[model samples]
Structure formats: structure tokens, C-alpha cells
Target: MPDHLSPDPLHILHEVFGYDQFRGPQQAIIEHVTAGGDALVLMPTGGGKSLCYQIPAIARQRAGYGVSIVVSPLIALMHDQVGALHEAGVEAAFLNSTLSFDEAADVERRLARGQITMLYAAPERLTTPRFLSLLDGLLSRGQLALFAIDEAHCVSQWGHDFRPEYRGLTVLHERYPGVPRIALTATADALTRTDIVERLQLEEAGRFVSSFDRPNIRYAIVEKKDVTTQLLRFIEAEHAGDAGVVYCQSRKRVEELAATLAGAGINALPYHAGLDAKLRQQHQDRFLREEGIVMVATIAFGMGIDKPDVRFVAHVDMPKNIEGYYQETGRAGRDGEPADAWMAYGLQDVVNQARMIDESPAGDEFKQVMRGKLDALLALAEATDCRRVRLLGYFGEHAVPCGNCDNCLHPPELWDGTETARKLLSTIYWIKKQNGIGFGAGHIMDIVRGKKTDKVAQYRHDTLSTFGLCAESSEAQLRGVLRQLIATGALHVDAAAFNTLQLTDGSRAVLKGEVPVRLRASVSAPAARKPRAGRREAKAASPAAATLDAAGLGRFAALKAWRAEVAREHNLPAYVIFHDATLAAIAERAPQSLDDLQGVSGLGVKKLEAYGADVVRVCRGPHG
Candidate 1:
């Protein structure tokens, strides 16, 4: 390790990033990586995963350890991070396909001269022969600092966003055995973590796994009914004038929903693989730079978005698994402010997911694993207990009822669903026995509810003994019950039969009265409604803004406006200049001088020297 790496990381953190202390295991991870040791960091999104490598990079460079090379998956992510580093007075650059040949050559020259502190490269570019030759040159000159592989979960084939190119990254360790390597990921399960370690050749790397809880995010899953109307109502009631992301599963849906939201007067944009590359980039830039802009997109939108003030993330369609759901929802409340994760899912989501799995070209084992994962998410959606507790439990963490989620805020009453389960299962069995195949939920529901539809009459199902057996229950109530049954493994969907309802072995127990079923009583539409907090209540609820009084709120808003102007001037994201948390601290403290401003968090020595006077003037206002 270089002597500069021996400096107190706290000193570097306070001077560079303006943070007084490290969060969670950041300090330890930084120390380990800076000491020329390998590490695997598993942290939730917005958990400061960047700093785990950034601080060490700066420390190593300051000590003359050479340039830190960051292998990222997205060019936009590189731009955002490097821009922030520049505003903090750190010398950073990125080389990717986006750069012109001349621009790329300039960056290369800088790297050769050791003029840059860090270099961010796309994994594809980093694995190229030219880049590898450049790295060899840097290594020969003893100017290579360390390697940071971000989005390490992409290395895992089992992960949601798997990239085959990441597998080629092992050349770093093979070619340069002395250079330390650190792999970081925002989302990863045990299996994915293991795969990351193996694939990245970090089998002996120190593993730092942080808690996967985002307490500031309130989770609510509603049954899909008139989805467009429900989505509009959610936006109007809970997230008016706030920046957010609405995730859809398909590109067409993304476009249609974006139009719908825009027609309704929400500043919305569509983003997906189908859009022109430049258009997608422009939309992403606007969302990062402006407030109250909602981006309606498929899963393509939010892999590396660094926006911190997104107040909500609404899912118009269900994700295929819990990991994807967790990673997507984790995008909200990144600044540790209170945010919402609202999703609307129904039986169709289940059918669609099953159909997708069945139609996929992946092997049977992979398909089975995917089906199991989807079932876990279904269980979470239909859970009657605290959503936070159940969600955490899926990741092997046990948590208490959060009191912030829909279930905890309004606990559902349990009803004896044994009779109901038996009735539904018997109806399915009867249909299969009589017609030689099972029917879809709708047809089965009509049979049980005694609806004489054309299909039901064509099959002569209206004359069966099971007809009208569930007339006391509404269609919605029966659907909810069936969904819960599927979640619990007593029922399943036969994808080969067009998602026909089928009974599992467990269903036999329920039908024989050997098992008792208790389920959340079905409520009407808007079952997952949460009480909307007014402005005062919202500010009071936000821990970051809680300390600010009326005057302080005004000051905070003024500071934000000034920051926005400075960001525009520098062609950087607003948060790059100063995060909302840092601004809140400054507004609450009301620092009137450089000396006083120095005490605030997030005002490092470089930033303090660069913008300290302006910040003090803004805080003091004209009266001072």
C-alpha cells in the first residue's frame, strides 16, 4: 500500500465529499480496499455504494498510488458520477463509446501522464485490447491504483440484469496480480453474490454485506382494477409536484402510459430500448435536472440513476421477482427521505409471468427457478402482515412490522378461508373431470357465481352441482382468495393450458378439512389506500427536513434554486453540486460565514473553497 493510503479516511471524506462520518460499513470497506485488499460489497441502492470505492480511489491517488479504474455498466452512469467528482474538485474522467476518438485519445494521454485521479470505463471498452494494453502500460509504470467493478450483480446469470460481457473482466486479476480489486453491487442474493465472487475471480475478497432495508420507503401493493384510473389517482393524491418513476413491463405500455400521464397534465416521458438513443438520453437528462418530472419507462430506465429526491416509484405492472422489485423500489427515498413504493398487480400479472416463463428458451431448471421466484413475489403482494417484514424475510433478514406499510398501517382482518378454498378447488376439479381439462379463473369464477356465460353454457357448466356455490362472495373477493391460494402453493397455473387453474397436492388437504385456511378479508377497491400527508405533515415526516422551521424551509428552497443555477452553469446534475441532505443541514444551521459553513456536512475543503462564500451569502440572505 502507498503512504497516501495511510491518511485518515475520515479526513479525506470530510475534505472531499463533505461528509463528516461514514455510513454503515463504508469506512471499513474503504480501509480494506485502500490497503490493496480485494472486497465484494453488497449494499442496497443509495446506500453510498459509490463511496466504498470513491473514497479509497481518492486516498490512493493522493498517496501517489496511481489512477483508480472504475468499470461501470452504463455510460450515463459514468457521466453522472464523473461530473459529481469534478464538482467536488476531484479529477475524474470516463472513456466509453460515447466519446469521440479525439476525446478518447485526450483522456488516454491524461491517464498516461497520471493527470487523472480516476477513470470510469464501460466494461465492454475496458475489456478491449487497446484498453488492456493501456492498463498494461499503466501497470508497467507502477501507476495503476485499483480496479472497481460496479453493478457487480450483472456478472451473475441469475440476476435480473445479467450482462455476458462482465464475464470477460477476470482478465484484470489475471493480467495484473498485484492490483487490488473491489466489486460493488446494489442488489444481490446469496446465489448472485456467490456467482459474482466466482465470476469476478474474487473468491478470497472480503465480503461486506449491509442490511437491505430502506425504512424511509413505504410499500403498498394494490389489486389491479381500472389500472389507469388507479395510477392517476395515486399520482394526484400522493405524489403531486414530485419527481418519480412509473415502471411498466413492456415498451408499448411504457409509451401508452407516458402519453396518458402527459395528457393528464403530468410532465412525463417514455423510456425503453425502442426509443431513439438520443431521445432516451435527453429524457434521462431532463429527469435528473428538473423537478416534478415523472419518467414512465420499462425496467430499462433506472439501473444507474443517481437522482436522490424521487418521492415515489409506482409499478403499473408486476415485476417477475422480488429482487427486481426490491432494486426498483429502492430507487425511491435515496436521500433517506420518506417515499412511497406503490404497485398494482392482479391475476393477469400472474398469468403473464407464467406465460413468459413457459415461452422462454431457457432450460427447464432455469424456468423452474424463475417460477419459484415469481411465487415469492406473489406471496409478498398477498401478505396480510407487514409488507416490510415479509419483504425483508425473502432476503433472509427478519424485521418487525414497520408501521409504515399499508398492512401495518391498516392491518387486515383474517377470515376462515377453508370453505372458500375448498369450494374453489372443487370447482376446478369438477371442471377438469367433466371437461377433461381445467378452465381459467374467469370461467371457473362464472361457474361458481352461477353466471350463465356463453362459454359456461357451451360446456354445460351451469348445470353442475358446483354452480352458484360461491354466490355469497363477490368475484373480486373470490379472485383474491384464489391468488392467496396460489401464493401458498395450494393452487397453481398450468401455463401449457392457457393459464388454466389447477390444484396442487396441498389442495387435497384443504378439501378434506385436514387444513384450516385463514386469509385477509377482501376489502373493496382502493384496498391499499394510505392517508395522504399535507405539506406540513410531509415535511414533519421527513427526517431530513424535520429540523427546518418555516423560515428554514424557505431558506432551503432558496438554496436549492441557487444550487440548480450553479449546476446548470457547470453542466452537472443538481445533486452533484450539493445533495438535498447537505442543503437541509446548511439551511437549518443558517451559517453566515465560511468558518461556520465549514462545520456543516457535505461541504468538503474543495467545495468550501470553491463555493463557500456564495453558500454563506445565500444562507445569510440580503439582510445579513
Candidate 2:
């Protein structure tokens, strides 16, 4: 029918997706799926992951007997994908609750006639008898191409956004064993990846694990003390008027931070589950469509969102796991420009996160796994070496000092943590043995510091054997030392029982002075997380010229005009395609040829090939 759906993926990739190349392991993945093989792809966000399966879907559909069924997690994502495919002149339709009865019936009729090449349905919809019956009908007619599962990380119980329905996706393979299946996610650790394989019954799937490194995003974690002031300062100093997200652990914090930003004359909005659905959607839409709009949100705000030009992602609270942190921070710099993954994390954030997990309806095993993940995130934050290396190492990738993160930009001075660890562990030990008690971090700290606080006196912890043992350190320094101990696996917290610090077997050697424990001194917290005074001064002194330069330095004013016009026309942010820095870089470099422009920083090879010629032509026009 459609020329037997060429087995060559590169041809199909160019013809259908209008792309001339494959990224990373996309070609290998496409071949695996097209050969009726199962695959799990772990590529980063904006890494051209969709092309892996989408091309194969078209190729299989052309072979005369199949329609590819895509199971997506988000309704909005389904709509956006289907709309994009339709615009590319491909036949695609999605079925979800958002569709009216008439629309549903029309899609159903189209399915029966095999008019649709690809169909997208949410997991909740797929399990319904109505939709399963429709799928059976299509398969019986030789109209089932393959199954493509998006956001496969949701299938893992350990993942941040695990969906129970995803556990049921195994039915697709059970019912249609011969059909190819592909499970794709941009974020999944080794454990989560294994869970995806097991839960989805993809034992035989060819796993494609790409490098989990996002080199363009600069990672930094500031020890969060006075988070509100820290957050305000960070947002104002580094990312003022740029598209960024300020994530809080609570909705109340989201509202408060949004109000703070607004009071500071910023266009900001609050987004959380507590808000009305319509209002949340409106705020999301505005954030997506309006440049310079800051979105203050809790963890629930971003999933399956396709905004490409977000420049920074600041975490006002620590995310629960490295997977969650990676996924959230991965949102920034999707355009391959320099972006900030700034976090203001403190010990309280850990307790609050643990409280949330402990209060959840999950099993003890689940809570333990979550706690382990949180511990891993803490290790990353406390690491004194290259932040990128430590982060990528968690995801099983090796990296060098990225020379972009704050730590890389300003390397911290590390000290021997061994003596400090010994003192801290010894303090925990002596306090436990003498008092027959395991206490919280604060009480233990007081005992170590020999402080006679009221609470310390109430517990008679002030006169413990370990009293004044760590008197050399201040209250804050002792807390930092303890945090590093916990991160290093020398200490554990028993959340199920009373929350108490328990020395692990790993701490035994340190307690016995059999081995040395070393730690890096924590950096001084950033000065109030505000915009750099120099940047502010630059803007203040050259406001007019800066404005004009942001408009492409007067070159291609018409392009700027067109960008603004089209941004309004499409209800999208003008910066979504390119940031002002990118534009300025292009204008200043003014590469007359595409080859020349490819050398400019921030212009990835694909982007250079895609828009380089046009940008150069615009640079040479009379608008300059």
C-alpha cells in the first residue's frame, strides 16, 4: 500500500519527520523496533527521542496492515503530538476525555476503516473496555502496527510520577505478542529502568541507554538557609526577565514566592494542584506564551510540557530523588543554550520530603527506596568536585568538570572531613550509649557542642559523655558536618520508628578510629541569591542600547518584528525559538554562511542546519 514501508530508517526519518539525521542511538533504536524488536530508550529531553519510534511507526504502517498505537501519559501531550503530526501532513488522531462524543465516534469510525496511520491514547483510556475492543478490532483487521509507550518512567513505582495504569500496559504485549513495542523515557535510573523492563514485561527488549549527560545545563546547589531571601536573590540576579521556573516544595510557598516576585515588579504566577483547573491552565498557558513570565510552582507543575526555551530551573526545595531532580533540572536548556540548574537545598528540605514520603500510603519498602534516592541527591549536592561529574555518575555516566556550574566556575576549598566525621560519629555513639537514647539532629548537635539549651537540659543530654566533644565547631558547622555524614552513609535515620540518627556499620570504622573520614568544607551560601549587581548596573547604564541589541542589534529588525508578530499569532513566547543572547551572538558574529555560523557557541549542528541560512540572510538585510 504505502510502498511496503521502507526498511531503511534514514530514508523514512528524512521523508516523514523531515529530518536529515539521527541523534545518539536513535538509528539503532529505530532498527530494533522496525524489526519487530522491543526496546527501552533512555535519552535526555530534547534529544530527538520521539524520532526513534515515530519513524518506525510510519515505516510499519506503510507495510499495508497496521496502525501504530501510542500510549502517552498526558492528555495535553497527546493533543500536541497529534496536532504536530497532522501539520507535518501525516494522519494522526488521539482519543482522550477531552474529545467530545462526536469526535470520539468519528475517531472510532476512522479506526475501523484504518484511516488513521497512528493513534495516540492515554493509559487510562487504553484499559477501558470500549478502547480495548476497538484495539482488538484493529488488530484483527491486520491494522495494528506496533505499540510505542511514552514516558515509560511512569511505569516504575520508584519514579516521581509513577502511574498505576502504566503497570497494566503489559496487556498490550500479552494480547498482541507479535507486534513490536518501544518504551521511551528521558529520565530513568538503573533501578527505574529495570522496573520499567519488568513491569512492562519487556524482558527481550533491546535496551538503549544513551549518555545521561546534559552538558549545556550548568548545575549548582547552594546550601539553603533563608530560602525565601535566597530564592529571590538568585532569581533576580541571574535570570531576571528570562523564562525560568522557581520550584517550591509546598503550594503555600509557591503562592508566597509568586507574590514576592510580583511585589518586586516581576510578572509571575503561582501554579499548584490547589488552584482551579482552568486557572492553572490559564497560568500555564501564559507562562508558555509570554516571555519574562516566572512560574512559581510545586512539583506538580511540569510534566509532558513541551516548552523548549526555558533558560533556568531553580529548586527552592530539594527534590525527593536524583531521578526527580534530573528530570526537573533537565527542563532547562533544552534548546542547547547555556542554562542554570540552581538549587537552594537545606537539611530541613530533607526532613520535609521524608515527612511527605512517611505520610504517603506506600509500603515500607517504597519509603526505604525513596529515602535512599534522597540520600543520593544529598551526596550530589555535598560533593566538592565537579558537580556535573557527581550528577552524571549517579545516572551511570562519566563526566568532567563542565566548567559551567557554580562549583566549576568557583571551585570550593575542600578540607579533611575525616577528623570531623570521627568527632560527629563518636558524638552520636557516646550519646546513644550513655543516655540509652537516639535523638534528632538538633539534640545530638547540642550534646556534641556542649550547649546547655532548654531542650538539651530537658533531655539531660547536656551532660552526656560526648558533651562539648565538638565544641571546636559552631552550631551551623556541626549541622553541615552531620549532613555530610548522613550523605556519606555513615549515618542513617529511622523514619518508621521515632526519627533518630543511627550510626551505620559504615560508621563503625570511623567511630573506632580505625579509618579516616574526609569531607569537603561547605561553601558559603550565595549572597542572597540576587541578580549580579554588575548585570543590573549594565542594564541600568545601557538600557536603550541593550533593548535595541536584544532586538538583534538593529540587524534584521524585520525578523524581530516578524518574531513578535508570529509569537502573538501562535500564542507562544518570542524567546521560545531563540534567546536574546543567542540573537545577539548571531548578530555580532554575523556569519554570512551556514558553515561559518555553525562555529558559533550555542548553535547546535542541527539547529545551525535548520535555521542558520535564514538567520544569516536576515543579518545581511536592510534591517541592520
Candidate 3:
């Protein structure tokens, strides 16, 4: 029945989940929740937030609270989490639409009789009257243990992934007053945090805000030239044959890039809401089960995924806010291995995101808030100091310069682009004034650079005093300057007029020399990226670089093969069976017996009992 055989949380931790000690605030959070205290935990993506709730579910169940109800947002997440819990020998089940009528009935019957230890359901289902009635029955019987809200930021309007359905979750606190509830999230700013607490009525809950820094994931944002070719080089040169995810802005881009990557001999797949539901599921399944599969997707695919081996997350376009970027990039390196968060950004990306916000039929206040968020992201991208510092600082946390980001590796030289920026803006103003209409960025750039192209000749713009005043500036450098000008509100994109440039009141400052415009000297050169980091990182060149001896490598490879077979037989992702780090440790030591495997980090009693002998057999080579 997956019952907890001990009263101690540490004992349960070792025996059930197989970890030696708690990390950061895990021990305190677990103890608080098990003793019937509510908590709001804000941890990074790979920071062991699951253990905070999962361990309490086990401990409270053992202490006679009966069953824990977990509120999850996605079915895929619930399925994978329940599958992993079952592997750890915890009695967990999820009741969603995936179950047939009889299957749901059976699960309900079991729940009514208190046969399940933990139950997972979406917020919509959890708040439904039918489900509440069942919960009432359990409440009357004193069977309800705890209520865990995962991704609690969805309750906030200011959050990146807000959902109106989450506002209905206040019912959990109102209905189950005494039941200890834990709200958990991976990304939440101070504003979103307050919203979550107020909306979920967790004001009295203990707040555990861990450091938001992810040291294992290096950050990089390159100026875009050929985005696909740049992405191809990134994947091939450093992360070839590694599992990655490339995020695009549109469904068509996702489809096209997936095909392009496949043609380049990379195993890639397309996943977006536009595809058929069945096909989307198939693509997601392939991405989960297979190694070295890159998923080209939009924001639709990456909320509650639990895959721990993703090597990189690339963005071909920029998102509207820092919160969204942080959430999407957090998907990589959940195993605490070295990974990357790479993006190809440019002036057009800024324009697209700004245009999206400007054209939306939203309130003025809402648009203002969105622009504020977008400006923060632009600052991070254009940062000359440290990307990590800029990112961590946005969430109201302070961090020193991380020597792992692109800026730290290759310091950018900022040039006084005031003369250049003024020239470009003046050219745009003159042309629009003469023609009583606006032109796109291309015409403006050509005129400022003295291109003497047919259009420039047709407009006779070469005769203007501002034309070719900054002919020495490269197009790339000018684009960087222009992007900064727009980002700083000195320029505006006339989305209603085919995305032509227009001057705002703020532009007058730059033109009158009241503001200075500085930009990176060489913006679009992707060849300048060099690898470096300040922290000691796991060698990501292979599965187990620490075990590079021929025998250890062979043993690790064989263990992985065995794990793949077991995962296929069980119909789960290979990491769900065991993490790569766990298997690598086992291979490095070449455990001689079952007792030798007892203290490995992820090897719980249940896992040892289930797969201990087979792991030993695989370690002893073919004839063992």
C-alpha cells in the first residue's frame, strides 16, 4: 500500500525518496507542513520543490490524515508525477478526463474507501461541485490530509501564465479550513507573490523563498542575423545529439523550424496548439521518451513538464516579459547538470513583441504594465555587465556578476551611438515629413548608411543633410542602437502602418542631445561567443565525463540501455525510472552488492527492492 513505516521525516526521506539531507529550505518546509502548518514555497525549477509537498503527503498520510489532494494544471504533468511516485512506491493516483467512466468510478470508489495515499486533479475538476461532494464525504470522514497547489502563480493577473480558472481555487481554503495547504511555484515576482497569497488566501502561510539563481544553466543572448543558421550552429557545435527545445513565436515557425532541423540531421519535432490534439500528444510523448529530440514549440508546451535531462533551451524570438522568459528557460538541466539558455534576439523581435502589445484591444493600464515588463527584458538582453545579475535582479533578488553568462565570457564594448542614433531618427523624420507617410526600417537604414539604392534615389533622400552622416556605422551596430532607442521609448513602431518607425516625445531628447545612446560595437556577430563559467560544472561532453575510463563508460552505457528497456516496458520516460546522475554514480562506483547501493541519492527502499538485483547484474557485465 506504500505506507510510511516510520514517524520521522528524515527516516521517511531516506527510506522512501532516498536522499541524504534536505537542500536549502526543504527540511524546514517539510517539517512545518507535516506539523499542520500552511506554506507558500517559491523555489527554482530544479530546486527540489516537489519533495516539499510529496514528502508531506507521505508523512501526513502515515500520521492518519488519510489522503492528500494535489491541484495540478496539466494532465501530462499529473501523469508523469504520479508515474514517478508509483516508482518510489508511493500510492498516488490522478482523476482526470483521461480515465474511462469505469476507471474513474473505480478510482472514486477506492478514494471513498481511503485506498489512495495521494490524488491529483486539475483546478477546474478540483473546484467542481461533483468533486467537492466527494471531498466533503472524505472531510466528514476525516480522510482529507492536505491540499497542494502547484504553479500557484497562475492565480495572479500579473504573472506570465495567468488563468482565470485559478481564481476559483479560493474555495479550497474556504471549504477545507483546517487542512494544511501548500502553494508552490517556480517563477513568481514580488508582485505575483503577493497576488498569489491574497488570491489563494494563504496570507498566514509561511513563506519560503529560495534563491532564484540557476547556476548550472548558462545564459546567452545573441544579436540575430540568420536565426536558423545561428540556431543550427548552436545545436551542432556544442549540443549535438543533446535534447533541446527551440521556442518560436508562431505555429508556422515551429513547424518550419522542426522540418529544417530534421533536414540538418537533427532529431526534432513540432509541438503547438495548432496541431491535432492526438498529434500534439504524440510529439510530446516522443520528446519525453526519446533521447536527443529537440522540440520546436511555442509557449503552449512548457508549463509543468518534469523532464530532467534537457541540455539546452533556445529561443528564436523574444517573449514579451522577463517572467515568461525565466519560466521557459527554466526547463533545462533539472538534473543539476550543465545546460544552456540561448536566444537569438534583434530589433525586429522587439518590434514584434511591442506591436503585439500595442495592437491588442486591452486596457491602457494593462498595456502600460506589459510595456514595463518588456522594458525589463530588453534591459536584460542589452546588458553589458552580466545577464544573470540582470535576470536575478528583476525578481527583487540581488546577485553578483555570474562569470557564466555571455557578457562575462566576452565583454562587449559600448560605443557612443548618439551621433548615429540621431542621424537615423532625423532621416526617418525627414522622409516621413516629405512624403507624408512612413517607411519601414530597411529604407531608413539604407538612407542613414548612404546606400544610394534605387528606392533612396527615387526618394532623392541622398540630398538630405542627415543622409550618410554616420556612414561608418555597420548595419548591425545601427540595428542595436535602433533597438535600444525603441526599447527606451525614444522611438515607436507604427504597427497600424505596416510597422514603420515613428518618433515619440521621448525621441526629442536624443535628437536634442538631452539623452545619450550607446550600443555594442559589433552586434550581429555570432562567431564571437566563447565558452566560460566561474563555477565548477559537470562535464557535459558525454553522459558521464567523470566516468571516462573505458570500463566505467561501458558500464554506464549498459546501465542506460537497461534503463531504456525498462522505461519502454513501463511506458515512461527513461529519467522517470532513474535520473542520469543517479545511474552515473552507480556506474562510477560499480556497486558490488545490494548493500553497496543503499546510500545513493535517488535510490529509495522501494526502488532498491524493485530494480536492485537487475542493476547489479548490469554492472557485472554481460555474463554476470
lDDT scores in order:
0.87, 0.76, 0.89
Candidate 1 ranges beyond 4 A from true positions = 1-6, 523-546, 622-624
Question: Would you list the rank order by lDDT, best first?
Answer: 3, 1, 2
Best by TM-score: 3
Q: Model 2 off-target regions past 4 Å?
A: 1-12, 15-17, 354-364, 430-435, 496-498, 526-624
Measured by lDDT, the strongest candidate is: 3
TM-score of 3: 0.95
lDDT of 3 by residue, 359-469 (tens): 989899888888999999999888888899899999988999888788887788788989888888898889888988898888888888888999999988889888887
Put the candidates in TM-score order, highest first. 3, 1, 2
The true-versus-predicted C-alpha distance at residue 566 of model 1, in Å, is 1.2
Please give the RMSD to the true structure for each candidate, in Å.
Answer: 2.5, 5.5, 2.4
Query: Could you tell me how far off, in angstroms, the CA of residue 350 lies in candidate 2 after the best superposition?
Result: 3.2
- Candidate 3: clashing pairs of residues: none
Could you tell which candidate, 1 or 2, scores higher by lDDT?
1
The list of candidate 3 runs beyond 4 A from truth reads: 1-4, 432-436, 452-463, 526-545
